[model samples]
Target: MNHALQLPRLEKTIPLSVVPSRLAAANAAVARFLIQAGAVREGDIPQAWDDALQVCERALDAWVKRELGALHCFRPYFSLAAVDEAGGYPSASCKEPVRYHKVDICWGECREQQWAVGDALEALERQQAGCGAAVLDVLREKSRFVYPLFTPDLACDVVSYVYWCGEENEEVALDMECGDNEDEREAMREEMVTRKKLDESFPAWVIATPRKRRLSRRALARLAQDASDPLARDIAADVLALATLRIEDEFRPDVDGEYIGFGAVLSWREDDLTVRIYDDLLQMAHQSEFCDRMGELEIAIDAPQAMRGWQSAMRVRFKTIRLLDRLIDRLSAGN
Candidate 1:
């Protein structure tokens, strides 16, 4: 048996019926599993416990990042101010902020459901093949069916995120989008984004089945051909297997129609052992923490002659507060 359970979501520790998702498909799968299992509990998939509110808030923050993606939709069309200029294309004065352009794309809300955990498990063990087929149906259509229903006129919402979907959806992205800059001016982007200045480089990424995205035969040959560090490259290939799950989470398609998705919990079927590639980023962010915090720190060496130290500290503090304030504003707008 190919282990009827699909995705790495079925860890060796989990039952064959348990299907976890780090993509939109999985969210639908989770929902369908609950329905079939008769474990439907009326609530959110991101079901936050009273004690877990803080953790939920942090996780939500990390997951709701693509709201500005709609802003890019505006780029194919208007200026930031023009969207709010009262009479710009799509009549920027409308109340909804996310504008719909390019008839090919749209977004919608993810529904709330009660997952009956016990029932789902029973169904999985007993229903067998039926359970697998049910989950797949939910995965492909539930969200896409509702995507075109939302109004796209949020002028102010341009900079905000849509929290309804998983971080799915694959359109080519600029390598220069280092996740820090918010300005969308074309002229300035050219000046600020040249080919990477740092030696570090991220590959051009896509969201898809791991089998398709895994280090390819051609990629292996290329890695072998390049001699700088063959062992390191081999190691990198292994590390990338885990990293690909994170990438899939980032680019998974919108099942709920919203730009950002209800984050997924994913796993994989590696030979001999089943594994998960990505988990919640907030909990695991420390894995990516820099080895050298000292590299960026500066020594006063000789104190600046023209600078009044307290005023400079105050200015730095002022900018920090503003940054946080903008962030909070962005979060509130989405919810």
Candidate 2:
């Protein structure tokens, strides 16, 4: 991977402070970069502001060409990022620069040939035209020109391009919205294809859990409709009930974008009395969101342990599974 770009002469002129938050740090860095580039003025007259924007646009155009190569090789697309209603970067008003720093870059026919955020460089390298390599090289060489300052690894990646395709244009609105469950995903896919005439897309890195394995509302509906045996349906419903609490394996950060949190799966056999819990459901239990639901379940009585050994964790998981099964049985029979 290439190292981050630095314009040494500009850096020498201005000292940038490291901010506590990633976004703030990036904003400060970009503002400093733009000021140095003469694309933005600290305090200036109205006519100078327009002139500065013209300079900024020229910079974006040149950088895009140098980094991405021929304009025809890429497609213009917009990404939606969830913002906190509370506070942070002030939301863009109609008249101001969109200041959208977080976005996805995709090439080809808008849908088919796009790279996921982190994977973009690798995909570009694969093109063999050296566009990807060139882009990374230029980016590293003149890093400040890009928005939402990020490492070569794409960590803390920010959108630096100020221009956007407006919402009125159907052709440019490439949505990356992923619904929580497979049904929702399918529904979104259908909407994209039939209604929007676009292919359903997702982040390249996310490994989607299989539809059958996920215990979602759609899974519950499938079990209720397809399972011939009453007990099987009840057990599946109970599992879905537990999993739908949407327990997260990671802690909630103060600021986040669109996310579909993790869910759980139960692996059981027809003859076996115990079921194996997959994924970090115990971690879910520890989260306050699930505390009340977990407190009511007898399985919560067992002390939650950080899974050190699979053998030991499996033993504990079996007990918890059995407890859940018994609870389901009683509830089903009206006990």
lDDT of 2 at 258: 24
TM-score of 1: 0.17
- lDDT per residue for candidate 2 within 1-335, as digits (tens), equals 99999765643434233323434433444334444444333333233222222343344334333333333212322111222222224332333333323211111113212122223333433432332333333222222211111222221011111101223222232343443566666665454322222111222221122111223356455764576656545544444444433222221222233211211111112211111111122333355343111100111101122211212323332333333334223322321
Per-model TM-score on C-alpha atoms:
0.17, 0.17
lDDT of 1 by residue, 1-335 (tens): 57686565534543333222222232333234323332232433344322222222233222223222322111111001111123233322334443221111112223311111222212322333232222222222221221111111110122122111222211113223333344643444444212231001111111112212234434434443552544434333322232222111111232322232211111111110101111122223344541111001111212322113322332332232222222222212312
Q: Against the true structure, what is every candidate's RMSD?
A: 28.9, 25.9
In order, the Cα lDDT scores of the candidates are 0.24, 0.29
The CA root-mean-square deviation of candidate 2, after full C-alpha superposition on the true structure, stands at 25.9
Consecutive 10-residue window with the lowest summed lDDT within model 2? 292-301
Q: For model 2, what is the alpha-carbon lDDT of residue 294?
A: 12
